[model samples]
Each structure stands twice: as structure tokens, then as C-alpha cells.
Target: MHRRRRTAVVVTSALLLSVPLLAACGNEARPGAAAVVGGERIEVGAVQSKVKAVRVAQERSPQAEQLVKDSGQLTRAKLYDLIVARVVEKAAEDAGVSVTRKEVQTGRAQLVGQAGGEEQLAAMYLQQRGIAPGQLEDVVRRDVLVGKLAEAIGATNGQEGQQKLNAAFSAAAATLDIDVNPRFGTWSDQDLALGEYKAPWITQVTQSQGAPVSGA
Candidate 1:
């Protein structure tokens, strides 16, 4: 039997909290920022700090070290995240889905509640993870905006519009042409052949194992 190993690109909640770090690192060393996205400048310090935080969290896992060693995989994943964020932000702006301060506060409260109450969750997230209180609100607000934009783009489910929404999403994904860098984690031609041809699960697994994990 072929077993397909799902290669999950793990981005933690802590990274979401460290978005400000993206601007801080950049402005510290030089006069200007490192990267700009959707007219917003990204700070090198912020990106570095966020990456460091992610590494710190991953240190607990054996896979973390190996993943770090894979520089291509790391870079590709980071770029992918940035691109997605920019795309979502642009889409939200186009749709005029504004994220407000009040909405952010509400979202933060809801998150805290979901994490099992404010005090305990705050201590764990703020004290332990070094995430500022305001950062939580920003993350929540961004997520809300993204959701609203997705709904506007017909990416949400409704009884009457389910099929239409599905078709729209499919067309959008096709148009996006999201090509994964082969040096990073990507499905190979062999893997695609197996998956597309509807080969037995076991056959797909065996074929995938023989294929190279990293590209040239």
C-alpha cells in the first residue's frame, strides 16, 4: 500500500503575532526598510525577529534542524507566505473590506476566549512567547480582513451559491499559476503522474520515495 506523506508548511501563530518585527529590524540597521509589500514597507529586523522566534519554537522538534539546513525550502516558504499576504491584502483593499480597531479588539477577545480565558492565555502568549498585547489584535484584524475578502471573492460556501463559488475559486487558482520552487517541497512530475493517473495508493507511495525530495 502506498502511503502519501503530507508535507505541511507549518507557520505558527507566534509568527502572526510578530508582524511588527518585520518593520523594526529593517529600520534599525539602515534608514529605510528591507522589503515593501502592497505599499507597506517590511522591516528587516521584523522579519529576522519573526524568523528567530519561529526557529526557537521549532528547536523542540528534530525536524526543525533539518528544515533550517534546507535553505531553499526556507526561502521558498517565506516568499510564498509574503506573496499570499500581499495578495490577500490587495484583494481586501479592492473589495473595500476595512478592518477597524474595534473589530481587532473583538477578534482578540474571541481568540483569548478560545484559548481558555484572558489571564491564562495572555500570560502564555504575551509573557512566554514575548508577543505584545497589541500584536494579537493586529493579527486578528488581518485575519478578519482576509476572511471578508475571500467571501467577497466568492470563496465561501452558501447553499444557493456553492457551485458558483467553487467554480470561481477553481478559476482563480488556475489563473494564479502558483508554481512551487522545486528546490523546496513540491510535488514531482512522477508524483503528479501517479496522482493524476489515479494509480493505486501504494504505487504512488513507492514511486514518490524513488523520486528526489529536492530539485537541482
Candidate 2:
């Protein structure tokens, strides 16, 4: 139980913040940083592109209405999530955590079996989660990496190595000098996650964050 909490805080939430010692990345005043993890710039444009691809995939699929309906929330959260994903990558590298392509393939197969088959897994990811089939494998690979990281940090079936792992994650995030554009939200020290903050006018009414490309 404690191990799960620790790993969830350190690696599982992957972006989920935990542990009380995280110092919010103080790079807000720095411009052009959609997010900066360990001083590496994750340009706003990169986030925008990823969102574009997701939107494109959504538009082409039959789930257009739900995709459009959740665009605002999805775009924002997914952007933040990707930024956190970068942070996770750096932390994993530092901890020597890794996964092979075969591992990812095997994991996906196992998940497919649990869901009854590939078609079913695709439905859950696409229809339910709004993630495209093309991106499903990427999602599975990330989970595999997160699990390896947890294992490396000592989050096993039953163990007490979470605090140390949390410390490591905090150190990595802090040192990376993370900063988010104010247009998105503030970085939360408590949750070790990005908290969305939008302009009053924008928040006054719910609206689409971005529209599908004219041709796309």
C-alpha cells in the first residue's frame, strides 16, 4: 500500500505529484517555455503539434462529437501530461530504468487479452479515452517504462522503498528547472502536477481551445 503511494507519487501518476518536498519550478518569467524540464525547453509549439495530431485523429474517427466536446479539457490536460511525460523520461534515465520494444509488445498483448482482444483494446483507447489507435502502442510503452521505474525505485508487490524513490523524482524535477507558461496553469508543489490556470475572459465561457486543421 505504502509502496504504491510512493511509486504513484514518484512514477505511476508518472505526472501525479506526491511527496511534500517538491519545489515548484520557478521559470514562469522565462518566455517561450511551454515547459522546461531540467533546463531543456519543451517549446509550446511541440505541445501544439501533439495536440494537432490528436485532434486530427479524433476528427477522422467516428467519435468526433465527444472529441470536440472534450477538446478543451483534453487539449489542456494532455499538454500538461506530455510535459510531465518528458519529466518522467529524464527521471527514468537517471535511475537507469528502461524497457525494450519486445517488452512493450508483450505488455500490449497482455492488455489486449484482458480486454478480450486487439479490437476491444482499440475501442477502449479510442472511443472511451479518445486516444487514437496509432497512439495506443505509445501509451502501452509508457506504462511499461513507468512500471520499470517503479521497480527500480523499489515499489514491488510488497515493499517499503517509496520515500527514497519520491526523493529521487523530486530531485530530478527540481533540478531540471521546470517552468510552465502561465497561460496554462501553475505548477503545484503539493500535487507535483500542473494546475491549469486560464484567463478570466477565457474561463468566463466554455469554448473550443483549438479547431481541426481546415483540410485535416
Candidate 3:
């Protein structure tokens, strides 16, 4: 009878020790993933690579210290951009919107003209948007795609149109089933945002062009 009691106590200790281990396993759904969107992993290495590119560009800029200081949340920002890129792609696909190579080139040219030169354009984006020079083309393409997607959905030139645009993006985001790693931040479908950073270029470009969400 004394031996039987010892065995029961041993079994209970083993079960108690496993509780924490099981909880840890539950938290790591995909090891080394920053997030999982549409059942695909956004690996930590991919996010770090983009962040490294931005840092490299910033280091070469005249406002290197200020740029780096301002983007202290650079990891989260880059991750946000990565997640939004996928969201924009899905939204555009659903809206039957497509951006061509010529459109991207034209968009870049227009921006360059506005900023005075290609170097100035790079500086402007890096300083204002935390976007690296190497990532500029992707940014331009996404911007153009957003514009086309807005038009395709008949997102008119006002608040109503803005609401439509948000709806389209929100729907796409919801379908993606975005799951962000706790170390970064959370995802919000309704806001079409990652944590506090809402969609940037979309709102900025729309408001600047005076085409949609004028007050926004």
C-alpha cells in the first residue's frame, strides 16, 4: 500500500511539470514566424531582411540619426508593411484591379518629378514613410493598385467612397485570417491596420488627390 501511494505521487508530479510545457507549445504555432496569413508563414527572417534594407538605406542618408530614431519601431513597421502588401494584393484581386509595369513606372516618374529627382524621391519616402529606396517600387505599385481598386469598386469622390474602400480592404483582411505573433502586435480587419498603424499610402494619397475621404 505504501508503494502504491508513492507511484500516485510520482504521476501527479509529472503531470504538474508538463502543464507549463504544454502551454509553451500552444503559443508557438509556427516557430520563427512573425505571423501567419492565409495559412502561410511570414517568417522572422523575411521581416528582418526588409528591416535591414531600410536600416542600410537610412545609414546612407543625411538624416540618418533622425530617421533611425523616428523609426524605433522599425521591426513592427516593416512587418506591418509586409502584412499590408499581402492584404492589398488580395483586395485588388477580389476587385478585379491590376497594376501594370507601365503604371508603376509612370507613378514613380510622377513622384520623382514632384520630389525634384530620383535621389530626392528616395529621401522623401525614407524620411516621411520609413520606406527604403529598394522598397520604393513595391510601394508605388501597391499605391497604384489601391487607386485602381478604389475605382473598380465605384468608390466615388467622398466619404461614401472611402467607406467602400475600407469595406473592400476589411473584407479581404478578414478572409486572410491574419494571426500575428505576440512579440510584434495585433491585426485589425476593421481598421485595416496592424496595431495603431492604419493603412498609410492609401489614406494619404486619396486625401492628397482630393478624390476620396476629403476630411480624412
The numbered model that scores best in TM-score is 3
**Model 1: per-residue lDDT, tens digit, 1-216?**
122211101112221111222332223433344444434554444545555654554454445555444332232224334434454455455566676787566555655665667654543443333333434444445555644444565544333333433343233333433343222223222222111222211110112222311111
Q: Model 2 segments beyond 4 Å from truth?
A: 1-32, 127-130, 157-167, 196-216
TM-score of each: 0.43, 0.66, 0.79
TM-score of 3: 0.79
Tens digit of per-residue lDDT, candidate 3, span 90-145? 99899788888987786677677767789988887777777788888887777767
Local distance difference test values of all predictions, in order? 0.38, 0.53, 0.66
Report residue 74 deviation for candidate 2 (angstroms): 2.2
Ranking by TM-score: 3, 2, 1
Better of 1 and 2 by lDDT: 2
Model 2, span 96-204: residue lDDT tens: 9887898778667666776777777776665544455766776666655655676677644332444444455566667667676555566653245566332110000
